[model samples]
Target: MTKVKVENLTKIFGKKQQQQVALQMVKEKKSKTDIVKETGATVGVYDVNFDVKEGEIFVIMGLSGSGKSTLIRLINRIIEPTSGDIYIDGQDIAKLDKEELREVRRHKMSMVFQNFGLFPHRTILENTEYGLEIRGVEKEERQQRAEKALENSGLLTFKDQYPDQLSGGMQQRVGLARALANDPEILLMDEAFSALDPLIRREMQDELIELQDKVKKTIIFITHDLNEALRIGDRIALMKDGQIMQIGTGEEILTNPANDYVREFVEDVDRSKVLTAQNIMVPAITTNLDIDGPNVALQRMRSEEVSMLVAVNKKRELLGTITADAAAEARKNKQTLHDVLDKNIITVEKDMLISDIFPLIYDSPTPLAVVDNEDNDRLLGVVIRGSVIEALAETTDENEVMDNE
Candidate 1:
């Protein structure tokens, strides 16, 4: 479901008359520079249209002055749009009156800012419950909720401490905890991690990714860093000069840029960081362990022209792997394939980054099995060493290589 949608969203910063003139200029397809020069109005976000799906991290990214921050503010009507519709669950938030918008902000949306917004005087728990406190939730109940949120972020022990006592990263966690305490439907994270040190930023990024597995809120994250966007965004909208340059997955944008600007914007990204095992894995050649005996497994390896086969049950749950030597030994001994199955085969989660898969694939004697760790270790695909190298080199299709060994 689309949790939030923006259609032709435009925000102009100027006097009323200037804004009106700029709006007309925009309707005339006037360029951002032309509109500014003609009407003395700055177009903050230009005709932006995008929908954020439910339970996704939709990142809006660009360099400074790219209007990414302005675009995010427009979504919640913080900076009122000059013209356009901001729909949250189909309700036109841009059209909502002050009190109506307040209710929506209070109940549905919570924003975490670049600065760790916390009170110096208040305890972490007190700061966290601040949102619920304003909503007139019972004190005891709000405290409980706040504590749980803090606990989820692994900061419950520090709940009694003031914000000043916590490190920058810990303070940010408190900020995140405070946002979650409200149980909002949408999280607007505007450069939330940029203020942190590099190492801390990455840790927070990993924590956010991990937290999303549990909360699954519609997250509209704004960032200036392309790497940060690719690492966390389910899909990314790359913006420039208050206009969107392109919107796509990291791989799509990297491999097939929409324009020259986007191409240059992502030209230097490390492909290994953007590509995951699932992006390069081929369909796994398998032998059904429950049904395929040693001879049947051998025949599959012969026909497939491979030395091994991934073993799986009827349900396609990964069992192990069987090498030609192991298969042949089982055949000579008149034993089932399972009797000689190599259950020690290395398996990688489908979402593992190619960078992380490199050492494991090259160092291993067999291709790594890509399994869905969340799905009972169900076999998804296989990632061979050649596939990993070819993916980094950008010379082969993701699912093109099926030469499993």
Candidate 2:
């Protein structure tokens, strides 16, 4: 389901051209020389259109003065549009009256800003519960919900602490918790982590990703940072002055940018690291052998000329993996090769980014299998630590080239 949709939206600020001209003439300043010579108000947004899918992390990205913030605020009805329509869950919010707009806002949307808008006098718990309390939720229930929200935000220990008592990240977490506590259908975040330091920003980014994995709320995040948009958005809408330049999935935009502006914005991103097994896996030969056999496995390993083998049981469920060293050691010990084989496997799904394989490469006991998680134990390919490091190096080189270009 589409959670929010905007169509032909436009916002114009300041006095109209004709009015300004008439006022200038009356003040004996000047007469309008021509309509083309007349300057009207600024257009904050122009003919903007897009739809946000339910449970998607949709991002609106642009440079400063590009109307991203205005668009978000307009969607929440904080600012009225000059002309256009906004639909939330199929209802045109642009048509809603004062009370109706308030009702929709109360029930359908929550927003987080870069500034943590916590009440200075209120404790963290109270701040989190403020929205629910305003909506007239019973005190006990709202308190419990606030506590759960704090726990989810990893601020349970600071429940009684005031906003000033916490770090910037913690305060932002509280703001997020406050938004989530309302359980609104949509969450709008406007550069919510932009004010934090680099390390804290990355921490918040990780926390937001983890939280999204669990909560999966429909979010429309506004930001000017390209890297941040790529990290968090399921799809990105690139905006210029009062207009959307392009809209596409991250990979689509990265690989096939709509114009030179978007290309330059993403040109320096490490393409290969962003690639997953889905992008690089190749077909390979395999053989089935008994786990109790030794001589047969050695002959098979040598004949295949492969360094390792993916292990599976009779049902083809992934059991473990075997390496050349284990096979040789087993042969020397006069034991079944399976006896020396590693039963632990560090692996990734075919759909995951190759970047996701880094921790496993650093931490795995053996080479990791790239499996098609949708299918049971189906081997996509295998990735050793060396291959991933090489990929990283290549990506670095590619980035350097892009920079130099």
Tell me, by lDDT, which candidate is best: 1
How many pairs in model 1 have backbone atoms within 3 A of each other, for residues 3 or more apart or on separate chains, i.e. clashes? 0
Question: In angstroms, how far off is 290's CA in candidate 1?
Answer: 4.7
Lowest lDDT sum, 10 consecutive residues, model 1, at: 396-405
Question: lDDT of candidate 1?
Answer: 0.91
Q: For model 2, name the residue pairs that clash.
A: none
How well is each residue in 171-231 modelled by candidate 2, as lDDT tens digits? 9999999999998889999999999999999899889989888888999999998888888
For candidate 2, the 10 contiguous residues with the lowest summed lDDT are 27-36
Please provide the root mean square deviation of candidate 2 (C-alpha atoms, Å).
6.8
Q: What is the Å distance of residue 374 in model 1 from its true position?
A: 4.0
> lDDT per residue, candidate 1, 1-405, as tens digits?
999989998888999999888878877878878988888898899889999899999999999888999999998888888888989999998888999999999999999999997999999999999999999999999999999999989999998899999999999999999999999999999999999999999999999999999889999999999999999999999998788999998888987899999987986677788778988999989999989998898899999999989999998999999999999999999999889988988999977889899989878988899998888999999998898998776633332332231
- Runs in model 2 lying further than 4 Å from the true structure: 15-38, 283-346, 356-368, 374-394, 402-405
